[model samples]
Target: MDETKIAQLRNQSIPPARHFIDGAQVSASDGGTMPVTSPIDGAELTTLARGTHKDADRAIAAARGAFDDGRWSGLAPAARKKILLAWASLIEAHALELAVLGVRDNGTEIGMAFKAEPLSAAGTIRFYAEACDKIFGEIAPTSPGALGLVHKQPVGVVGAIVPWNFPLMIGAWKLAPALAAGCTMVMKPAETASLSLLRLAELGHEAGLPAGVFNVITGEGPVVGAALAQSHDVDALVFTGSGATGRKLMEAAARSNLKRVYLELGGKSPNIVFADAPDLNEAAKVSAAGIFRNSGQVCIAGSRLLVERSIYDSFLEKFAAQAKAMRVGDPLDPATHAGAINSESQLARNLAFVDAARAAGRRVVTGGTRILEQTGGTYMAPTIVADVTQDDPIVQNEVFGPVATVQPFDTEAEAIALANGTTLGLAAGVWTRDLSRAHRMVARLRAGVVHVNTYGGADITVPMGGMKQSGNGHDKSLHAFEKYLDLKTAWIKL
Candidate 1:
């Protein structure tokens, strides 16, 4: 960016951010704050209030009060729908600021964040808002003299914890439906990328949402997050992150209120290419997108590539060249396609996985080392590894980076076996022109979403989530509404 633009952005003096609770921004109880550093050039962006257990308690109490008081929950579905649509409009109005905030805070590519993340978040809110008044409860006749009515109602207080990669987008996946269903929520966005959501909570209030209907607490998981999970008042907990943390949250929920726990965890999804695939170059490009896009921070990234033996060597060559060509630089650069790994720890973890893969005797096809060392930013070139086996740790584990492992299979059966080798069944991609083969692969693959030609092309209308260790509960579409709602069947005897 030009110096003049940079100066203007810096002079914009965004108010010092704090926790949004009970419809207001408040300081942490202990006056504690955590330094939020920019991953772009390692600049200190700002300091955020470090919420503690007390903050969580206050937020939950506010949510509980709002729900019990029927201030938000008592509103008609049409009213909530109107309020949520206004919230979406507010997000769209502030898209540029929110996108820039995400870029500075999370180190995502500015262009991608500017158009994709914030805009998509606004669209999501709008989509779910449209569903509010359309939700239908069913009525059925009993065998004899009774009638059964299935009434769908909110799950009460929902505690949502979204990750850092696409905080605005994924946060919408949780918040929109919860709000539309008349469930008040206390959300804890990943501390690494909490700014936009805090700003979002402020927008919620601006959109005329009731006080305490939506709240945000900023801190690490152990303190504020665990407080939400362990709170007896929180009716349900929704999370999207690593499985290890998900287990802890589940245990906390089980130990306390036994609240309904919904999780969307990690994945090692497969991108299978057959010999008869139309346009090998296109397939190769999408395969690159499955991992290279967002620096492979996506949970359902197709990190494992299973190519037919006939196309194995050829596909690897094309994929490696594409991976090697990905531009890595400053996040704010519009031309830059790849940016810094979100954090130092994440960069370390990504590099460690490469080191382990090398030690395990896998041949590195392209990138395996860090780049842009002088900028003080955490940057890495897209990496591709050949000779990956079904049992390789890189294939079995979720390497949430720009790392793709290629393996060759003999037949359709072999491809299916290799793709389904891991415990994760979040997503997979099949590249073949044969209609029968596509259908066959789709049916056999144990994934929640199977892409026929494209690797990752989805919208807010389509339900997204995973099977097996990738965690349960859908995140998008009308199905996601079910997670935040409970069904009550009333039997009327005549």
Candidate 2:
């Protein structure tokens, strides 16, 4: 190869085999490996160890050993706090490199990845690190001579299954709290984006996390993921992915050992814009950003845009115009607003949603096509569709791409009804000047999160989760630690 070709290859390929088990880097037991591919283009990024069931067994055994051996869980709260903080600091040192790997593997815009991914990961880690010392046991009031107390203890051997999108952030969400609670864990990253998670294990070792306290095994969901879910040694499984996959994992956990299963699933969240919205232009822009920011690949993408009939036409016009102007190109470009779809399969899936919407008589206001001219990366223009009914597939299902379906409602009640019409209730957004209406909508909406005059706005300090089919448990804030710990009540008679 020419020097330019060699440089391109070098830029695309990841480093040699690195897998952390028992606080050491080792090859897979069976000498198997899987090649990591860049979602932006068809480039081989790296070869990760294709972990097997035996590896899963060994990882689980190691975690069980750590937990039972009492090296971590037995430590004082102050000591655990110190270790977690050190881990956070080490992660910060490698944040930029990890962010670059995430962008390359998942096709996220590099600039946005650099800003959001690392901050999201580090903020979550720091939040949980500080929380380590604050989690206190309560002394219950008891009759004269009797005594009662309640304490929270770490749930041992957490098996975390993270999705391809926002791999680093979600992995941190699961890891930070578990580590803070003094729980050992085995993590499984999506086959499409496992590089960053593996890299995290290396950093964790550098930060002095105990052997088997944090292990990452990379493989397909059916193999490695199922093994983790079904392993009797695993005490709990935390997952972020599609609702169907979540259900399957739950079933596996039930059949195996009845382990605790916490999930954050898919969403078809609504962004409701009323006629009384304070700033139509601003609302339209925020709405567009929420849906197009991650190429609509986010689980909480505001894919269903419900507009009040009084301003429906004008809102659609503005939203469509803004979406059409988005720049879809290389993810590394700072000016690129909408980057490549994560993979070819994702691009195909997105195009199918557009075709289905058209066939269902929905109107495509702009950008119902793919951009093959935009390098070898999979690029789809930000799409806006109107005339969609509540029963339409686009409105009901998680499109998970840069496609937003718009519908008009005649009344506040109708808007609220349409907003809560999906099986998934992860999040919802409202744009209105009326404080009373915003509060009322927030109250009535079934979603766990509601954003007023905004969409997809989130903070690390807030509890984030959903009800119904959107799955159980929260992933952020102080409340998140509850998922990794078990509470026990002690009663004594005097």
Clashes of each: 0, 0
Error of 1 at 407 (Å): 0.8
Best by lDDT: 1
Q: What is the Cα-based lDDT of residue 238 in candidate 2?
A: 96
lDDT tens digits by residue: candidate 1, 1-494: 34355335533655567999999999999999998877887877888899999999999999999999999889999899999999999999888778878878898887678766779989998998889999889988677788899999999999999999999999999999999999999999888899999999999899999999999999988998899999999999999999899999999999998999999988899999999999999998888978997888988888999889987888889898788878888877778888778988888888888889899999998888888888877888899888977777877888898899888999999889888888888999999999999999999998989999898888888899888898889999999998988999999997
Q: Indicate which candidate wins on TM-score.
A: 1
Q: Model 2: per-residue lDDT, tens digit, 1-494?
A: 13343234337556755557788876778889888767677677778888888888888888899988988888887888887788778777766677777777888886677667766787788888888988999999889798898989999999999988888888888999998998999998888888788888887778777888898887778888899999999999999998888989999999999999999997899999988999999999989999998788888889999998888899899998889878877776667797778888888988898899899888999887888544666888899989988888888889899999999999989888888888999999999899998899999999989999888767788988997799999998888898999999999988
Worst 10 residues of 1 by lDDT: 1-10
TM-score of each: 0.97, 0.96
Residue pairs in candidate 2 whose N, alpha carbon or C atoms collide under 3 angstroms: none
Least well predicted 10-residue stretch by lDDT in candidate 2: 1-10
Count clashing pairs, candidate 2: 0
